[model samples]
Target: MSMIKKRRMIEIQQLQDDSEKQNVTRFILEALPQWFGILEAREEYITESVNKMFFCAYDQDRPIGFLYLKETGKDTIELFVMGVLQEFHRKGIGRALFYRAKRAAREKGYSFIQVKTVKMGIYEEYDRTNQFYQSLGFKEFQVFPMLWGESNPCQIYVMTL
Candidate 1:
């Protein structure tokens, strides 16, 4: 199946500073935890002092979606959080953010990408999340109980570039 192509007017760029980062907060907050299953799981973490990699999807000058990532190893990265405003979902914004991040990470010499979410049988939202990652060529790497507890059953997926 063909994935959506990013609109010509839309740009995906790395978040450069505090102000550009701040602009996407409202859009990120629009998605529920059921949607992306962020570790912070709320808006309060957007500005938190975590070592993060961010890419924002902008339509013209409006921030529509974002992806948050962190280095888990010298050559591996974790997709920490990602979301698009409900009105903007499935319009290729999230897919654009994802592929941009992947390309950037690969260019930076990272070979592996990983993202964690609530396991499939537990949350309906995360089931789609897992499927989305899989569609992008990520595979099930492992399932462990340490991070989010037993019921959550953290599912980790990995992709190699």
Candidate 2:
């Protein structure tokens, strides 16, 4: 007899309510220390304005990853946060969320999608993050020193489609 194995399914959906907001914020806070040198309590204000939020990579209905995107202007979108639960990292969930964000941007008629990352600090993952964006066709467009604060230098990248 042959046995069949089922593959895990992932679903991406916009966060639609207060309950989802809490879940998404919690996920970001949990992932922030590893990616951001310092996590600020005030960042929740930005999260609350997430124009587009994606919940991705679920295992039997349990969320394993999420992405938060915000609009910068009429024709611009910014990737605010994208992260996967620790157990689900390196499984392509991040990339999937990225593509979804791009598609959303395109649908909204955004000419450019921008992402900002710290240029230096304990956040060495910024390099990898920048490379990942470049791999997805985004290019370095600008660099702002102390953009987020007195100590954080930000590198801005833009993808034109």
Candidate 3:
């Protein structure tokens, strides 16, 4: 069988219930400490996701990845937080969630979808993250050297919808 056909199926769906969203966010983030090791930030993401647009990628009933979108401007939506279990990395689950995010933004009439991550070159794990966002057509918008702390300079990327 081809590699694609050999892989298990994954489904992406928007989560509506507040409790489910928080639970899934916590579950996925806990499995990805390399990206979400900061307890305060992780907790904030779990809590705030209830109000933002949220999507979860599941293998059967188990959540393997998730993405959250928050309206940052009248015409801009930010990819507020996202995580995929390490085992599922580069397996198209993140890309699938991203396409869903782009479709949601375009359907909502947003002009831009933005994402922020630790600047590339500062960390190995985040460098792959930067690459992933760039590969998905997001371009560098700006940088906030102290936003996440001097050790983790924040790089912002935006994709026009």
Candidate 4:
């Protein structure tokens, strides 16, 4: 049997409109099942904050992924959240989104980009996720146990450019 190939039609661009915002939020909600309970902040709050400086990935005019960054300090930026539609995972969309975020951070004069992840039983893909960041040159700065709360231990990583 012959397999049909899916074209890689991904495009990266800054999320600038309300429709894009809704698409991103919906994608996040669908991609991250545990976000509602584990994350202390509301999705809308995070989306609004990130919308101020965010980039999205679209495939064939459909929003497929997003990467959000925020200036945390004078020379530092935080990668708040990044995810691709579940079906679109493992298709290089994450890497493309990351590069876009990094470019934006560099443009903003940030010297470092940071990300934090929690160590929870539900996050079996943590190792893979961390490895992906490290592959992109991020270094582990700190790993705090139960930092967010009694049950949420976190691993903080940073990439210096």
Among these predicted structures, which one has the highest lDDT?
3
Question: What would the per-residue lDDT of candidate 4 be over residues 24-43, giving only the tens digit for each residue?
Answer: 75666565665434444545
lDDT of 4 at 27: 61
Off by more than 4 A, model 1: 1-8, 30-33, 36-40, 48-51
In terms of lDDT, the poorest run of 10 residues in model 1 is 42-51
Which ranges of candidate 3 are over 4 A from the true structure? 1-6
Candidate achieving the largest TM-score? 3
Candidate 2 whole-model C-alpha lDDT, 0 to 1: 0.70
Better of 2 and 4 by TM-score: 4
lDDT of 3 by residue, 1-161 (tens): 55665568899999899999999999999988888988998999999988788999999989999998999999999999999998998899999999998898799899999999999999998899999999999999999999988999999999899
Better of 1 and 3 by lDDT: 3
lDDT of 1: 0.77
CA lDDT of every candidate:
0.77, 0.70, 0.93, 0.75
Residue pairs with backbone atoms closer than 3 Å in model 2 (clashes):
none
| lDDT by residue (tens digit), candidate 1, 66-118 | 88778889999888778787777667888888998988889989989999877
Range of the 10 consecutive residues with the lowest summed lDDT in candidate 2: 41-50
